[model samples]
Target: MELSQAEIEDLLSRAAKGQIVRTDFLDPAAASFTRDLLRNYPEVNYKVDGGYPSAERVRFAFFPIYVFPEDVELNIGFIEITGNFKFQTVTHRDFLGAIVGTGIKRDKVGDLILIPNGCQVVVDRDLVPYLIQQLDKVHRVSVKVKEIVREELLLPEAKTREIVAFVKSLRLDSVGASGFGISRSQMVKEIEGQKVRVNWKLQVKPSYEVAPGDVISLRGRGRVEVVEIAGVSKSGRNKVILRRYL
Candidate 1:
C-alpha cells in the first residue's frame, strides 16, 4: 500500500487538532494504510466500522485521545430498494452504478446488503436525501427507495466451504489455489496480474509464505482464511484447514 507522504501528514495534523475527523469508506488496502499511519500518533484515538459486522470495506474515524464518548455514533444510513425482482439477479454493481450515477462519490457509500425482497445500501448520512431523491432506477428497473433504521438492516449469513488439504509448503499461492480450486499456473498468473491480496495488501509474489490466521483474497474468486496448520502429514506434507467464503 503506497500512500502519499502528504496524506499521512495531513491525517496526523488533523488528529493533533482534537477534532473528530471522519474518512470516506476505504478499501482494505487504504484502510490498512491509514491504520499503519495512525501508529505514529499515540494521542490520536480511532475506530473503524462499516455499519455491520464483518464488512470488507469500511470507514475510519479519528478522534482526540482525551474524548472518549460513551455513545460515539457513525454517520451512516441505509437505503432499501424495493421492486419486482428475483433473488441473485440484482448485484451490488447494479445498485452501485445507480448511486454513483447520481453524482455521489464512491467513498461516500458503504456496504450494499442484498436481502430477499430488496437491497440495502449504506451511505454517508448526509447523502441520504439526495440518494432517496435521485436514485430512481437500477439497470433500467424502476425501484422504490426508503431509508431504514440501522436496527432494521438485515445481513445474509456468510457461506463458507471448509477444506483440509495436504501441501508441500504454506506458500500463499499454493494454499490459496488449493483452497479455491484454481490451478497453480493460473494462480501464478493471477498473482502476477495483481489480482491476489493477502490481509488486504496486494501480494504479487506467488512464493510468499502464508501462516495460520492469514486472510487471502483472490479477485473474482472470493476470500479464504487459514484456520489452522494442524500438523505434518505422514508423507511429510503440511495439513492445512481453510475456510473459503462463498
Candidate 2:
C-alpha cells in the first residue's frame, strides 16, 4: 500500500511554510507514490535518502523551494550487533524480528547488512540509543549492540554473474528463465503468481518484452538484468546476455 494520504498532505502543507518535513523509511511502491505526489507541488524542495548508497528503504524530506536539500539535516544512524556467531548463526530474519519485537515500527528501520562478525542495522538516528539498549538477544544468542558512525557502516558490493541465453523472442518468460536459470514453465508460473517484478513493478504477463537495462526480480530469488541483446543469430534465434545478481 502507498503512504497515507492524510499524512502526505500534512507534510506537504507544513513544507509549504518553509518547514522541513521528513517521513519514515518507505519501500519502492510507497516511494514511487510519494514521488508522483511531489510532482504536483513544484514549489516544495525534496530529497530522498536511505543513509547510505543503494539502500532499499529510503525516506523523503520536503522543504520550501527556497531551502537547499543539502541544508536539511538527515537523522540516520547505524548500529553494529556482535554476538557468538561461531556457536549460533543469526540471519536477517532473526535480527529483524528481534528489533521489531522491541515495539519499533519496521518503517523506522532501514537495511540490515550482514558482516563477518554480525549484522549492522540502519535506523533513524533518534532510535539508536533505544535499539542499543533494548536489543540484547537475537535468535537465542546473546548480543551486544553499539552505535557506529556513518563511516563505519559496512555496505556490501553488488555482485552479478553474466549469463547467456538464446530465445525465440525477448519475452519475459523466455529471457527470465535464462537469466535466472529456471525453466520457461516455472518462469510463467512465477509471473502469474504475482511473484515477478520488472523494474520493481509487478508484471504478470509472461509475454512482456524486456529490453536491455531492465531488471526483473522474482520474489525470494535474486534479480536478473538484461545486459545486452546480441541480435538475431544464424539459427534464427536472439542471443541475450543477462546479469544475475548474487
- Tens-place lDDT per residue, model 2, 30-60, is 7766877888788898888887878888888
lDDT on C-alpha atoms for all candidate structures: 0.83, 0.88
Error of 1 at 123 (Å): 0.6
Predictions: Cα RMSD each: 2.8, 2.9
Worst 10 residues of 1 by lDDT: 1-10
Instruction: Mark the 10 consecutive residues where model 2 has the least summed lDDT.
Output: 1-10
Report the C-alpha displacement of residue 191, candidate 2, in angstroms: 0.9
lDDT of 1: 0.83
Cα lDDT over the full model 2 = 0.88
